[model samples]
Target chain A: MGKNNVEQMILNIPSDLKYLGAVDAAIQDLAREFSFSPDAINDVSTALVEACSNAIEHGNHFAKDKRVVVTLRFNGGDFVATVQDEGRGFDFAKALRDEAGPDPMSERGRGILIMRAFTDDLKFKCDDKGLTVELTKLRGGGGDAGQ
Target chain B: MKITQREVGSAAILDLNGKLTGGPDADAFRDVFKSLLEQNKKHIIVNLEKVSWINSTGLGILIHNYNTVRGAGGDMVVMHASERIESILYVTKLNLLFKSFNSEDEAVRSFTAAR
Candidate 1:
């Protein structure tokens, strides 16, 4: 693939956890197509799953009527994934701050932290439609993958 | 996730196969742990040799159960975690909290050794 050419894949699923495997499979295939290292592929797959989980559990509230849409794109140098949900969004910044405490025993709030640790860039957007989490991984970033 | 329980000496080992993500898996894991606690099996070892994937939610499940076991005056350690799972635990600094061993024998020995 040329640097100027972009490849993309979109996955739409209900707010169900069982479909997460499909999301992971799609991410693995795309990451491989981009020649991501084995560790990098795992990194992207993990981060994407976190993003999708948040969308399903938090944003969509597990409503069967709701949907989580994921977009995966690669532009030769970077792989990006956007997970969008169909519900009102929560406070991303506050959640991150609350989870930043020294307590390691807390069982409820490490999703965003893990996403940040594994991805090169993380962005969140909330509006009337829903919340969209954008995650980007730079090719060959060699950033603590599977550490 | 599929959980199989076996007792090696006094330690109850929960061998897990498949992804340990949240949802029904969390409930199933909790049920198993609760049953163990009811049986007074405090020392526990989580065997993750066959877990293909685990995310933060799965890690959270582990933390909750680990705390539960500790509160009951017992301990829970892990064995055979994949490199990917280890990475998640490391990034969360949970590697410091959970004693991990490469083999089941070592994990079972940790309980007796601690005494």
Candidate 2:
């Protein structure tokens, strides 16, 4: 792990959902530091963007005063992102993938499925404090991401 | 984010570029969508290749446009979506709601094809 690699930065933002771009910026900076390929960086960025949105929308329900804490860490060989929320967590097995039918008609409900598809590792942890989503994507690895 | 609109062959093609994460981008998208409705051009094709990311508000704007246009006997088609953006569209099941194309030309062609 590179010592100067940010190795960690946590930012807490209001659960307003409107401030998602702030999360996007932080992710971009962390991803770029690894010299990730344009396409690779794009994959992680897109997944993380949707993850942050779900944290605010589904987990926190856009409650303005509530907060979502995002932890970013870029080690030499791996990129890890953790989005923590104070709201209740969600069910993964019960998730739906109707967005894959093609023809581009469905208008909502697709963030988490996309996160799992793009990132190498996706997990949801729900305890008394609330929910924490940990996503891990390796740097410079072929992995299972589709182009 | 910036949404620029133009008319091509009885269709309204909105070129959406930049991040659309519900801040200024969301309102800007709404204003643009509203202007298009006022202009009476209903069949729409949105170019989202340059749009890297968006939150729920951005997706809601699409729903708003879809409802408005369909009410006017027109529908919205999406064209030239980058892969990352396409994932968002797919996960949201919007792929069924919008007709997406590999290029703007293909999307424009679909207006007549779908008919």
Candidate 3:
């Protein structure tokens, strides 16, 4: 059932900011193949950049030995992407609570909020190994693909 | 992003072309803003007309610079954000933080009109 209709792709990028452009281009191409609207493509692209940036900066600590892996899958008209890092995980619950506060002028902490706002579903997984951020976007419409 | 700066009265207009995503410490951007601050040009206008895309890191760069300028008793504004970039700002509520203008003239006028 999983392989029947779902197509998946993976990208592994070194913990360097320069590779973010390639990540965005790859996600844009995948979104195009799925016929996501222009707005949807933009949201996904921005979210992917944020997730990958966080992985490279926070999770991988910009260490050349570390790598960030991105997996993208289109399943039954919905898109799912995951960004994984090799460093210790962070406090996802605290990050979410901070985003819920009313501090629009704050410079930091908005990356996760933007990802959560754009994607239908956002989940963070942490273990002794590392951190992984999962993002989902449903077909059609703009702004948070979930109804 | 490729950034070019010029003086519009006391305001510094930064014209950015290309995606304003990750770079090595985003040095290119940081350098330009640093120069502006050194020159005592606190009021800044970032022209995003040619920028096709931006992400959280890019936004963070802008916000970081914004605070720096504000701390120095100056300010920063953005103009000509493409529809998609505007959407990112709106989603993050950054649209409320950095004042936005539709045209370079309007942005320049704003800085001069303030003082």
Best by TM-score: 1
Best by DockQ: 1
lDDT winner: 1
- Per-residue alpha-carbon lDDT of candidate 1 for residues A48-67, written as tens digits (9 for 90 to 100): 99899889887898899999
Q: Report the C-alpha lDDT of model 3 over B20-87, residue by residue, as the tens digit.
A: 76555377788888888898888899999999787777877888888889899998999999887887
Clashes of each: 0, 17, 0
CAPRI grade of model 2: acceptable
Which of the two, 2 or 3, has more lDDT? 3
Where model 2 places Cα greater than 4 Å from the true spot, the runs are A1-6, A96-106, A140-145, B22-40, B55-64, B67-72, B90-97, B101-106
Backbone clashes counted, model 1: 0
TM-score of 3: 0.90
Per-model TM against the reference: 0.95, 0.77, 0.90
**Each prediction's whole-model lDDT (CA):** 0.88, 0.74, 0.83
Q: By TM-score, how accurate is candidate 1?
A: 0.95
Candidate 1 chain A least-lDDT 10 residues: A93-102
lDDT of 2 by residue, A15-91 (tens): 87556777877777767776777767877777777778788878888788788998888876588899888887866
* Candidate 3, position A32, lDDT: 85
